[model samples]
Target: MRRDQRTGDHRHSLPAQAPGPGNLPLELTAFVGRTAELAALTAALETGRLVTVTGVGGVGKSRLAVRAAAAAAARGGAWLVELSAVRDPDLVEHAVADALRLTDHTHRTPRKVLVDHLAGREVLLVLDGFEHLVEACASLAGDLLHRCPGLRVLAAGRRPLDTGGERIFPLAPLPAPDAAALFADRAAAGLAGFVLDEGNEADVAELCRRLDGIPLAIELAAGRLRALSPAQLLSRLDDRFALLTGTRRDVPPRHQTLRTAIGWSHELCTAEERLLWARLSVFCGPFDLDAVEYICTGDGLRADDVLDVLSELLAQSVVTREEGPTGVRYRMLDTVRAYGADWLEATGDAARMRRRHRDWYMGLATWCELDWFSPRQARVAELVDVELPNLRGALEYCLTEPDETHLGQYLAGSLWFYWVGCGRLAEGRHWLDRALELDGDHDDSRLKALWVLGYVAVLQGDTAAALAALQECKDEAERTGSAIATAYAVHRTGCLALLTDDVERAETLLRSALDQYHELGELNSNVLMGQVELAMALAFRGEIADAVVLCEDVRQVCEDHGERWTLAYALYVLGFAAWTRGEPATARELVMRCLALDHAFHDLLGTVLAIELLALFTAVEGDPAEAAVLQGAASRIWPSVGLPLFGSGNFGRPHALCEARAREQLGDARYEDCLAVGARLTPDAAVSRALRASSGGKAKTRRLPLHEGRAGDGLKQGELRPGQRA
Candidate 1:
């Protein structure tokens, strides 16, 4: 929400001011020292168009403008329209209408009604705190500025309203001397016995400077004088920054603390506004109006009224509006949101609000899971990008609450799309572990979670964990007679077996899973996983033609379903098959395509696998330096998932071949170092053997010949080699 200070015509409705002597609103009280600011505001108002006062929070922009507007009241009736109360950008015009007391029910559009009411009104409209409603404010301000020749708009906000012909008066902090004087004045007013002396002047000056010369912060610090002497307060300031707002017994309690300063604006809210603010605290990031209406306002509150309540909150400074890439969004300051969260907890509705939050995220994730396999995969990825933080919050909430443990498992299971397709394998594994630890009786939910855990584990090269989890899930799914679960478990088990070079068992399990997927008409990424495993098994059996065909089929299905992650895996298989068949150029092209897509999606595992394969391609081309660089890159990305060279057993042999060539080029010392590094990574017997064998010039190839068995043979000689092509 960076501020664009070029436009300033848009204005928010101001807070109501009490009428005072000479029929003017309460003249800015004890307005300590803003002579230059007042002069600038006055100069902007003289043109009678639109003048916006902009500054950071607590800078006295609102207070100074109130005085300036009161002074201008002699020339025209100055009406203060506070927009901090308005939360919905769509209701900006309605807030103005309310501020003006325009009783026109006939006009449906608030903008039109406002225009009709103030078409010729000769009055100065003081719009205060309009940073949130820039767009709507701009439109309304433009309309009013065009229609009302005698109307003048004075705005005060954190940032300028970027409307055409809008003059902006940037309000800086009060000067040091003036800020010190004002602090002393406010302190003396609160504490009759207070006195400013040379002993504490330097500390007090530093305090004012640290407070950024912001009037509210100074006033808040000055209020602390009620309890402690200036010297004592200065000494304790470092420990309790919030204690700067000293208690004022006589002033309205709402003005007692900096929290209260913001809360006063909150207390002025209508009941609906207050409730909405409390509910909105659940969100961690900016949310759109539709999300607000869906998640916050409902049941007891009218959905349509959400707009009004949002407007009220915005005007009261409880919520700030922001313009996002999609549209206008609203958010609360972290401090303000923390305060609202406290209120939410006090209301005994925390559980319900959390439920609503979880439900919204659950529904969103479920939709993405289904949509990820469609032509809208790219669009679904974008949607997931926006909702990711909220989804994480929901997952966290579900995992923490005892009663919500099952829900957490369900959420993790449902987000298989995000985990597998988006390359969130590491995060998926982390949450899956937490969900399983809950020990809930959600066997079905646990089954899905287990499968996902196994999926991530397999990708990370944790064969034991992958096998244990998938086998457990398979047993449970079969016991429960859950066909879909069984199919998924079987498919993933095949993947694990393939990673371990058990091509015969891998092919058997994959074929079984494929049969079940076809029987159940489940043609999603789960089914794609089965086909990929089958292709890998075929490649391992040396049936390169069959492997190539299966890879092609999977790629087409992935394209048709818009499953880029699965497509990336299919490309890896296709490229490897081509590389083994001596088509280095084709292998390079396919591997590069997979690399490009994986990088775009931030799929760490996919990126590593693609890089490793590219390194093999470079080795095949006799370019060991380039091959080593790609291998190094893969090694760097490998540890992130803690499963170095996890799921690509078929590719591992080729990678080992490439590393040998690279070592030969770099000399025995560097090659031995690389092998030493690889040996210390993890206890994979195959990798250990590969490293040992490659160290010697006459390396013993442990590859089991696939031609020793039939087309659908199982594991033989503890290794699976490329079988004879059909």
Candidate 2:
């Protein structure tokens, strides 16, 4: 049977798991080698703000953080709010309220309740396992920090709480000496005959170091002293997992094994919670409660129950909740998730659960794609941001599943908004590539996926892949008589051609797409996207005035429709036009606005591009320092998304120009060094390629004249010019 992924309980020990926090009591003896960390944490508490203790799993972050909170109890009451049990970001504050023993009769927002409870209290709130609930934690922490000036927060998780005035202390494993001491201490306490002599001191030290001084691993290893001798255990330390078994029977059996410790937590969950836990195991990052309700709940569990179960899980220290600009979200520890997956499989429901997970994510992607065209594009972006991890998980599952490949393809194609609006070209390319490799029978899905693949490739400067995918998509769409698909494929093909400097073909393909879009009546964001492509083609072909006019038209429609993303692209085009026309100050302002919006939306690729343009504008204005700063920021962001900068057509010209200017001002040696640094920071070719090909191309094209229609089009009636669209 598969092991539970939540608390890492052994498969054999599954039956022994118990419910509630009391069942798995915190053993102070299990916590070791965090003296310095505890000291620093206590010190940070005095300084106030949200003090976050971040570390990898099994590193004893929770134990240490809790210990610190307990210690702080001497000065002021320290309320332990375990967020690991909370699955819904919306209920994050409620979970904390529950932990603090606060009852809200008025149904006030959790934030308000929390503030009221914490307002006058000179207390230390220990919010444990809050990586998943970062945003919620941030808001709560920020509020507490502001309102309850006397209150302090000690947060423990895999990452920092990210609140303003957040004092982050990254907890690493214990030093070898301390770890060895810990092992000896725990071994002596747990086993009657355990002893660490000179002969085995080196071996024990080696073992501690191997465990990376993680307290949980140390405790688990010490528990095994009942079965293995110190020397024998040292020898078997290479396969430590095999050597470590049966340390204590009275303790929760999952606590005996590293994996089982997490699994034990999974075993104790209710059926509904367990199902949600399993479904949620699919995510790769944080997710919101609405996503949980939509993706993880169904016939077995009511969608509304998601909040209740999530709240229960958070309270139980199983699921983690976070907050973002748009709302709260939840996440899981990689180790904990692995344990939940074990239980998920053991329950004989892996395949069905995975399918449900896939379906829900697919629906979400479709919804987001449709919503991207609306005036609430920014709001849609926020929603997507919170759901991205689950979507990626679903895509991954589909790509790996033989029968579900088409779903993966469809999901990838459906995320065009994320790719285009947020400048996630690199990430978009990654999913597209994997999806394309699968044998998808759905022609529409295939066509959409392929077109997106082509778009990503174009962005990454992979002309060959871009052309191949676009050609295939175009052929498939034409064969299937899919007008929408055909239009999308043709438009993207035009984008690729434009990027490669193929002006005439770009014009022809873009024009055809535009006509098709017009014929489609009430065309969605895709139609506007196609228009953007046409405008880009016009710009590249030197029709500057026409391009500007076209961009203005798109800008107005995008705004009228609440399409902030489209507006951002329009602003980008206007900035470029301004640069071409020698309007440096105007270009700077427009590009800065675009950058600000992109950054706010987590559009890393868009932010980078905006920075690149801003850098150029700054250099043109003789501000090398500002230019270098912008260039550096861009260089840092590009690599994460898998974009190649130097040889890629998408960024090559800008990169070359930036480097040359930097070199001219900063001298050849420094400039070359900066360029080298930038080169090294290239985004992953696969992800970047896809993003560039799809969204990047659309954003670029939106600047050209082809999409503007005639000068008398609706765009001219509104003053929403391309320069200030964002």
Candidate 3:
């Protein structure tokens, strides 16, 4: 489905999207002067299974690919995976998975997720900014093209992926007319009353020609309109272009042109602007003013002058203003940021700026974690989602530097809310696993990371990993005398017990953990979640009344603090209790609320549980056919999440009962047919159908038609829902 390109946070709303219909950002500015290129690309992709638009930096490859994919993939849709910010080769698959928005709860490799999701869909996979990950991309694309018959790979980068059967479309500089038109358009935006009129058309053409017709170059040169006219700009550029290239054999001529253009723009910037530009290169993704102020200030760039200097950069087109869910932010194009990075390195300030960047994001993560415990929980999710790239950069910095392992552990441990609550379990595992491999100086930080890893593993149904991590954390915490670490270790061990269906042990351990938390005066999402888990254990042990009472208390606290993550779990337990007591109406309302919160937070496990529960409700409502379909939808999602019903008798009973009833109402063949219908719906479509089915649209009416494909972007994958455990 189409999302507003302006609100970038909307793109980050889900954990990444499950493969669905197309999602291409609506171009903010008009796509100009690529008519032939667009036509050629469209034709290439139409006939070729793997087409790469290769060009030097700033030659409009990405832009042209986006335009072509949008047009060519009209039937199945296109999914854009941006790899510029992702540095690790191993994460190339994860980056693609995130782009496709696969919400798998299991520890399955990202390659498996992509192959499984793409095998059936006729979708164009657009991999932009992937030059840095060429080998990985080549491997992945080769595998996908071999397995997914309907899939097409459209990649944009500086070089070819060099895979078997790959088609390389080397992009050249725009012709004179198109380049001049691009300048006229960007120049008009930068300077008032600027147009391609008889007065300056020739000069504009000459300027674009000299700039080598590179889009980024043209845009940057156009920014000079505030200080110089087209004629004046041409006069100044003649001198600059004379020595722009001809001797650099290592770099392509187009690359040289791009570099020369950027260097000229750099030369044009004021000293403050140039310094700020170099400093700003430290950011991996779009950054807000608050972050820039915190990390980019100082270092000869006065704090108070950051705003003015940044404004000058923005005005000069060095930094472009972009909006996200959090409001206005700024971004530097990849090529420009690269140039700034080179400048930063030349100034010998690269390491310091990188450290500052890491520190700011670390601070941001800490604050967001705290905010996660308050009513600003949803807002925190938004901010984290928007800053994930930068946060990932921070985590990499800490983990890569030998002396910073402790900080890496702390950072990973601190983001438990984002990892578990926001449904980033797999990616969280990637970072935590990496952080934990090295020994940190601070045992407490490592212990915290250990417990969080255990908690995530429990959710992913990785019993061995969960048990090992938790046990080690307990042993280390006890040895180090860290009560907080011990408390979390115990708490997550209880979670592992619950997932594995050891309800009695779960109840005992969870109660102990909660006590430890209370004694330590620890009241946060984790403590409340421990309470909720205890209630689940109680519910599993047939103590429905006690479970209800405990969850009710947890709910009250969560509401008081505006906490939704723990609140969702509490609601799940309470809703199940309500259904047990035969209050179907109230049960539906409460569970629906839980589902809404879970989906909003991109909690795959929570969303799946709600869907499963609603399907059971529908079965009892005399619409066995509709109920069976919902069950099929849940079944489709369970693989991504891990084992269905968590292999727990308590959780499985409801699903079993619903299936039996549906079979009785509709014969085996009819019921199986309904299941197939539901299974065919994309993950997001199924959730949408489930939510709609749970609403006034009753089982009998079944007004909403379950379809085979996705309508738009949605949460389609699954993991263990909060109340889904035994």
Candidate 4:
């Protein structure tokens, strides 16, 4: 069974309240004087498929693009994908996928997944900070436009993306009066009772003029109001930049002015604040107080001092803070981060600080992975979601640094569930493959990563890769005497066997794995899933009663642990057992319940299986038309999963039976029409329709067990698939 592409999950997870808007960041402070630019950008978006907002850093191009995107999102949907932190051209699509919140599980390329997602939608994509990845952005914009007719691209960069059909909207410095007004507003925010009046009005105006009307420089300069008067600020700028002297002709004037403004801010900071600023540059994404306390501590900076110094830096506009889902997170603008990075490099502590940063995230991933099976599973996913950029940065450091390859392997091993459960199989494989190849160590971490690789390959339907990885894991386990590694390898081998229709071998392997898990007291999501797979293999081999017992045990354990991801799989196996028992109503209820849990997590494999089972029940219950439609929908999703029915005769039986029955009863034309109808329905709508069908057309209420007891208790169940025969 295939996993749901992150694109589908991303789309489903969006806020349902306003389908009209996408994930545009809220404009916290007042948009502060971009009226003309906003208007022009909005007009450009109307007339062009691509609109490029081009300007040097700090010219307010991003602000303008955001304002326009929000407006467009109000009409349709607009998503903003920030590209400033993305350094690799190969990762451009992944960056976009992250922005779209696409957790695709398929082995398909990120670009293909994104294209499939946007193909039929009318939405706007705001690519912010595209200057670093201009060529990649241009190609992406062109391809997206070609694939999606209704798609619009809004790019913000120092230079244009240069995609064909782009309407370039050049964003210059804020006009003189607007810049002065911005500085005055910022100054008032910083220093109470400050106003733009006759006293220092000329000095403020001259300061803004000297700063080249760059919004960031104006804002940073304004932040110095508490210590420096407007006249003093102008004098400092003059002394720093030596405006009377000849400026570098090759370099841009605006860049020089902004750099001087930022440099002056840095020079004025206290020693502790300066150190904190430099150390804080290690974070590639937003960070919380706790993280800052940990990563920036030591070497003359105590944990307690970080808060006060952080506030001071915030006052200086070196870091921006916002309340996020978890808590308040702080981030530095690209220009600010660049300045701090320079200082960090100069301090010669860049390498050590980076290692510390990687270590912190590695520890974080370990903690999250250990907690993944508990009630905090959802929260863990959310936490990992927020830290992905930082995590990616850490991974890059570990993989690129020769000495850190082992740590990279360990980190990749620790994030198995996040990569597999969260629909990042291809990326997970990429990291694990690289880390494993770079180093050859026979420890617990390497073993763990090997099993994870095998599992991921199995999900991708690469039997050869799965077997090769599992064989290596098994051989190493025997050599190293690691029982946990042996058990895990055995479990994944069972999964591969089950997927390949070797039910007997699968059942044997799964039983062995379960025994080891029991002996070791290992009760995680992975172990629980092993039990569920055992039940599936039993059911496939006509051991329906025993399968029911195993599934019930798995489900009870999952409920006891408050585990949802594994419970969904248990329900699926149980639902399959119920369907074979010839109780259509019982089967329908169980399958629909399973389908709901699958859809909730965007688990595509579980979802399609439930749907296929539901179709089989409908066929036996005499609603062949609806069954045909459901079958058609499942058919469309099968390709994305890599294998249809996972090549399992047992899993394939119901789908094949349902199709045969529906086609025979409805004939070709009517069957095709009904199929098309089902195909047209979105995944959510299809699930809803299937639930309605399962409920026998009454208002639906969810129930756990389909019947009083487990299946095969003289229920006259007959096999619907290839393997089972009742």
Give the Å shift of residue 530 in candidate 3.
1.3
lDDT, candidates in the order shown:
0.68, 0.65, 0.83, 0.80
Poorest 10 consecutive residues by lDDT, candidate 2: 13-22
lDDT, candidate 2, 1-726, per-residue tens: 233232222222112212222112244344444556678888887666577888777777776776676655523366777666455565567557556644322213457656755665667777887777888778777877788776777888878877688888888777776677677767877677666677777778777766667766676566656656666655665544544445666743334455543443444468888887777776657877766777676669898678898887775556766667777777776666766777678877778777777777788788878877886777887777666656766877787777788888889988977865565554576578777877888888888898888877766566787888888988888888998878777888887776565667988988988888788874666677667667766765567688889888988897778776656667877887776665655676677677666666556556667767755644444444444544665665554333334233433455546555566677766665654554433233222322332233311222223233243222221222222211
The lowest-lDDT stretch of 10 consecutive residues in candidate 4 is 6-15
Model number with the top lDDT: 3
For model 3, the local distance difference test gives: 0.83
Ranking by TM-score: 3, 4, 1, 2
lDDT (0-100) at residue 183 of candidate 1?
A: 73
**lDDT, residue 726, candidate 4:** 20
lDDT per residue (tens digit) for residues 151-206 in model 1: 78888887787888888888877788777777776777767865557777787788
lDDT tens readout by residue for model 3, 100-187: 8887778888888888888888889999999889899999999999999999999999889999989999998888766776787678
C-alpha RMSD of candidate 1: 22.3
The candidate, 1 or 4, that scores higher on TM-score is 4
Error of 1 at 485 (Å): 1.1
Q: Kindly list the per-residue Cα lDDT of model 4 for residues 384-443, writing each as its tens digit.
A: 878988988998998898677778878888899887776677678877888788774538
Q: On a 0 to 1 TM-score scale, where does candidate 3 land against the true structure?
A: 0.93
Q: Lowest-lDDT window of 10 residues in candidate 3?
A: 6-15
